[model samples]
Target: MPAESRTAFSFNNSINPSTFILIGIPGLEEIHIWISIPLCSMYILTLVGNCTILFIITTEQSFHKPMYLFLSMLSIIDLIASTSTMPKILCLFWFNSREINFDACLVQMFFIHSFSIMESTVLLAMAFDRYIAICNPLRYTSILTNPRIAKIGMIAIIRGSVLMTPCPFLIKRLSYCGTNVISHTYCEHMAIVKIACTDTTINRAYGLFVALVVIGLDVLFITLSYFMIVRTVLSLSSKEARVKAFGTCGSHICVILISYVPALFSFFTHRFGQNVAPQVHIILANIYLFIPPMVNPIVYGVKTKEICHRVLRIFYQKH
Candidate 1:
């Protein structure tokens, strides 16, 4: 909160320059080091786990199918999303270095939200993949070919990039007017927008719109996909067939829950949780970003037999 902590440039029309101070957690600065311990461990685990998944998917010819390709995409997004925020978070916690430039903050915000959208899109794609493989196995090979998967991946990237492109520009138009301390660890969208002294109605509306479009529509479609999948699965004559169908979806379901549950909690709390503690919001925000990346690979690695075998085979060979 000190003048020395902020590096603001003079603007001509009396607008406050864009600079922010990120207090890791508002009332818990004393335990930042303690907080960093588990966060750092999660980040390390995220890196190692996602990287291993990527390595296995890339190196193994057996993993060239649509499912594994989509898994690889998820791993990549998790890596980028967690990396975008975690290092700065660690810096804030470990070294008490919390000054982030406006442009830098915008870039961070862009990546965080963009990758979040990307992850959701990827999950939706995976749901579609599951729906196809379960409901229409005969067309599975013909439908999700490598080229079609590549297009889906490309569309996911472009959709996220295009939708989130306006966010930073919209934030740039707001007048900070010297109120620029963000309570959260990272440059979250609403967190940054809330500090602006000018009217943030447009920003708020657009933010909500984006959330509804990306998260809302995607969740709906994913649910619909699963609904059809379950219907088709139930209609299968043999119990073993039904069991196998459900078994294949277990890991994706787990990943989807971890990805969305914390995210929705943080999203709603940020806007609606007036009685909620600030620390709780901040902690859950970080958890939503960190937990998915850390858990996705573990979920898949354990649930997917091929990955488990290949991982064990590598360790066995190394040993």
Candidate 2:
């Protein structure tokens, strides 16, 4: 490859900061305009949707149960997750399309990862809630009472924040001698860490470990929760009870699958499938981050009839 191409390729590894303006994907710069419009619209809608969910669950007497409480927590996480990156991303498509300072980049990466970890943990909690409701209905109230639920939610948020703090701090310590252009829309941990001038052995290893610990543990717990849920549902005496239980969990399962499957695909592909097409990477990247927020409210509203009716009532009242 020519020197320019080589420079672009090695930008991630170089520690010396040469002043060069970062530009996004070629032939797709104009496309970002269109992308931004929809993204901004979606971000607004996500905020509104999630906020509505939270308000409904909090204020409604009917939604005082454990299930809606968990749903409210999930909505809060989704709102934060989407907010962490989408605003910066949309800004990049507009006036602030140039250099992102190293410090700002690190900040973005930290929140993005932190919120993602929180989202996963919240999903795991949701799974456990489902398991309790289905398998031990008599004790579901006692098991996931307000105090216990609040404690678990706090633990999830704190764990995610503490675990992801090191990633940005590690990235900050590394030298950036080369080009600073990040390939993707956001300052992702791996994408940013890969550019360090020093030996990123520790960073990469720690990142891999964090990814496995967070994603793996969440997946495992979610799977186990569902396994128990399925067993309980199957053992139910009436088909109606089984259907109701499954129906209650359907939105959660859909949201979980949508959020995690793409993430796993991106994770593995980034490691082992480097040679894959940039388009594939871009598509998966967008889907992994963006789609979940867009669909979360839809899933909840569709699968949970009460939330749906409440959301509709809110809309009607607004107009």
Residue 17 in model 2: shift from native, Å? Answer: 4.9
lDDT value for candidate 2?
0.78
Query: Which regions in candidate 2 have their CA more than 4 angstroms from the true location?
Result: 1-22, 317-319
Per-residue lDDT for 36-117 in model 2, tens only?
Answer: 8877888888888788788888899999887787778878878877887787777778864656666677777787778788
Query: What TM-score goes with each of the models?
Result: 0.96, 0.90
For each candidate, the alpha-carbon lDDT, in order, equals: 0.91, 0.78
lDDT of 1 by residue, 1-319 (tens): 4542334333323355646888889989999999999999999999999999999999989899999999999999999999889999999999888888889999999999999999999999999999999999999999999999999999999999999999989998888775567889999999988878889999999999999998899999999999999999999999999999999999999999999999999989988998999999988998888999999999999999999999999999999
The numbered model that scores best in TM-score is: 1
Clash count list over all predictions: 0, 7
Worst lDDT run of 10 residues, candidate 2, spans 17-26
